[model samples]
Target chain A: MPYVNIKVTREGVTREQKAALIAGVTELLLQVLGKSPALTHVVIEEVELDNWGLGGLSVTAFREQNR
Target chain B: MPYVNIKVTREGVTREQKAALIAGVTELLLQVLGKSPALTHVVIEEVELDNWGLGGLSVTAFREQNR
Candidate 1:
């Protein structure tokens, strides 16, 4: 059994969207990895925008710098 | 970015085992899903023995029932 955790920026996503995303990912895992959905576990966490970083830059800063 | 969460019975697993499990699962995802490790985020949570249930039975009870 594989357990998966998902963390995302909560600002742009709705509760329904989050649920759909989880379900979609779960399906993807089953379809792609040949794993059983019932045996898999998924958890979602929403983190603050400022806390997320990419390439040593905060997501906010990365967006601004790229823009 | 695909974020994966892993929840496991932490009782029998050591800290090193946990880290290895994460790395193994992460590698499995990358190898199986063609995803970038940098883009994937994984979180591991250890739940109490009483909290995890499988097939409508708690892990503890399931083991007992099976045995």
Candidate 2:
């Protein structure tokens, strides 16, 4: 059972994009590893910019700095 | 950006095994999708069996029933 959990910033992701992500990941696993899409699970988790960090800076803070 | 998180029951998994998992996944992405190893990240989370569920039952309960 291949379970993929994708975490992205909460930046107004549309339902269509989420659907595409699920389908694309499922297809990738199927094509690359011959995994059955029926059993493969793709979960998407949206994290707040305040919570996601990069280079010891929160995404929010980083953006504020860059701006 | 490719960041992968793997969650498994807290069954005393060794450090070497976790390292192998990170390396294997990184290699898979590199081989199949041509993702750069430097950009790929793998995080492992050990979950409590009581918190994980299967078939509407906690993993702990499921095991108790099956035994």
Candidate 3:
């Protein structure tokens, strides 16, 4: 069983986009690893800007400083 | 930064239970990997019984057969 978890800053993700992500990730796994889709699990988690950080700065603050 | 994706067979999981899971997972990462909580991402995905399988049998079918 292959379990894939996708995390993206929750800014403007739409339902359709999520659907596409789920399909695409599953397809990629099947192609690369020959894993069965029936046992493949793709989960997307939307992180709050404040909760996600890079280089020791939260995405929210980083975006603000850049702007 | 550490990203964690938790996939569990979706059956009778409550919102409170999920919250506890998120918190526990985050804490575990911090203790083991010394990852920061601010940048740690934890997402829980609940898989349908039909979508999760073991030994080529879907969880739904496996449960039924065992029952």
What CA RMSD would you report for each candidate?
6.3, 5.9, 8.9
Q: Rank the candidates by TM-score, best first.
A: 2, 3, 1
Per-residue CA lDDT of candidate 1, range B3-58, in tens? 66766554665677656655665565565445477877767677776678778888
Residue B61 error for model 3, in Å? 20
> Considering only N, C-alpha and C atoms within 3 Å, which residue pairs clash in candidate 2?
none
Model 1 chain B weakest lDDT span, ten residues long: B26-35
Query: Residue A28, candidate 1: how far off, in angstroms?
Result: 4.4
Scored on chain A only, each candidate's TM-score is: 0.72, 0.96, 0.94
* Regions more than 4 Å wrong, model 3: B1-67
Q: Tens digits of per-residue lDDT for model 2 on A1-67?
A: 4577766667777787677767766665565445578867778788888988888899899889999
Please list all clashing residue pairs in model 3, or write none if there are none.
none
lDDT of 1 at A34: 53
Compared with the true structure, all predictions reach lDDT values of 0.66, 0.71, 0.76
Considering every candidate listed, which one attains the maximal lDDT? 3
Q: Write the per-residue lDDT of candidate 3 for residues A1-67, one digit (tens) a residue.
A: 7877678898887655666666677778789999897787665667899999998999989989899
State each candidate's clash count: 5, 0, 0
Off by over 4 Å in 1: A28-40, B7-38, B41-61
- lDDT at A41 for candidate 3? 67
lDDT for each residue of candidate 2 in B1-67, tens digit (9 for 90 to 100):
3577755567776787667667766665565445578967878777788887768998789989999
